[model samples]
Target: MDAAALTLHDMTAADVDEVAAIESRVQSFPWTRKNFADGLAAGYRGWVVRRMGAMLGFALVMDAPDMAHLLVIGVRPDAQRQGVGERLLRRCIDHCRQAGLPALTLEVRPSNERAIAFYRRHGFAQVGLRRGYYPATQGREDAWIMTLALAADAA
Candidate 1:
């Protein structure tokens, strides 16, 4: 689907169930509902991407003075490779830019090649790795730390 066809809106408390369901389906080790709830309660910037009333994906971003961190991002299994993830990511990037954040960062499972490629395509580069950062059925998984610097002129 065309990325332009999707609309992104700030996530509200009412969207927790739908967002959690999609998150669970998209990841083997999804965040619990409480995680999202607490993030919202803590004033993190959360957004949902939708098309024709259907939720395509969601993203959660935590803002700091110097940088913004993407705490979580997910696209429905059926919606993978459809540009929904990019739309959600762009929304976060825009938010950081508007908030005057100099950089944005996120961690992804080292084994998730598709996600790694996606972030790379969006100008994020692998800057580090976190050993055993994610839980997995076998045990734990490492994560690649990716970062993007937003240019002031670009915004």
Candidate 2:
């Protein structure tokens, strides 16, 4: 896909089917359709990236009083290294700053080295750990709690 063709738009119910499909393919345990429905019903800020009218990636974020939680971010497998994930993440970070949210936090599976490194390169730091945060075939897996402090000017 050509990078120049990419566009971002607010996620809608019409986009959830494709988003959920990508999520299932990219994640070990994906969020169900109802989960995305509930997220939308709760008014979470969600967005999707597309190229040629096809969904390439999506992000879901929630804002609290002083902080924002990056609930989920996923890129289609074919779009993984084509800058789609970074684009979504940067947009999410930018939105957090614009919302005056001091920080953005997310929990990532410890085994997701690529995601961890990607987040690190974007200035996210591991602040804590959640034991057995994910269900595994053999047992539960721990999750790393990472946070990024957004610079107000960066918005």
Candidate 3:
């Protein structure tokens, strides 16, 4: 599918089941539907990408007084490599820019090379690491803390 033409909409409670389903399929550690509910309750900014009546991806970012945190982003397996993730990520960046935030940050499992590479391509830089940041199959794993500094005129 040409993701470029996909419509992006604000995520709602009715979309939680489908979003959680996609997260479970793509992530080793997926967010539960309750997590989505709590995020929405706490007023996080969330968006869904859909086209031809199909859900392609979803992203939720939390805005702080100074920065934006990319809490979660998930794209369905069939939608992988179709630019859905990029479109979702661009939304995060734009949110930070509009809020006058200096940067957008995220934590990614070091093992997720695909995601790390994708963020790097989108101008994220690794700034630090957090021990036991993510739940691993066996125990826990560290996460790379990445930040994308937003220039006022940045694309």
True-structure lDDT of candidate 2? 0.91
Give candidate 2's error at residue 41 in angstroms: 0.7
Model 3 ranges with Cα > 4 A deviation: 152-155
Q: lDDT for each of the candidates?
A: 0.91, 0.91, 0.92
**Inter-residue clash pairs, candidate 2:** none
The superposed Cα distance between candidate 2 and the true structure at residue 48, in angstroms, equals 0.5
**129 Cα displacement, candidate 2 (Å):** 0.5
The TM-score measured for candidate 3 stands at 0.95
Q: Write the per-residue lDDT of candidate 1 for residues 14-60, one digit (tens) a residue.
A: 89999999989988888888899999999998999999889989999
Task: Estimate the lDDT of model 1.
Answer: 0.91
Question: Which digits, one per residue and each the tens of the lDDT, describe model 3 over residues 19-108?
Answer: 999999998889999999899989999999998878989999999998999999999988899889998998888888889999999999
Show pairs that collide, candidate 1: none
Candidate 2 residue lDDT tens string, 105-125: 999998999999999999899
Candidates 1 and 2 compared by TM-score, better number:
2
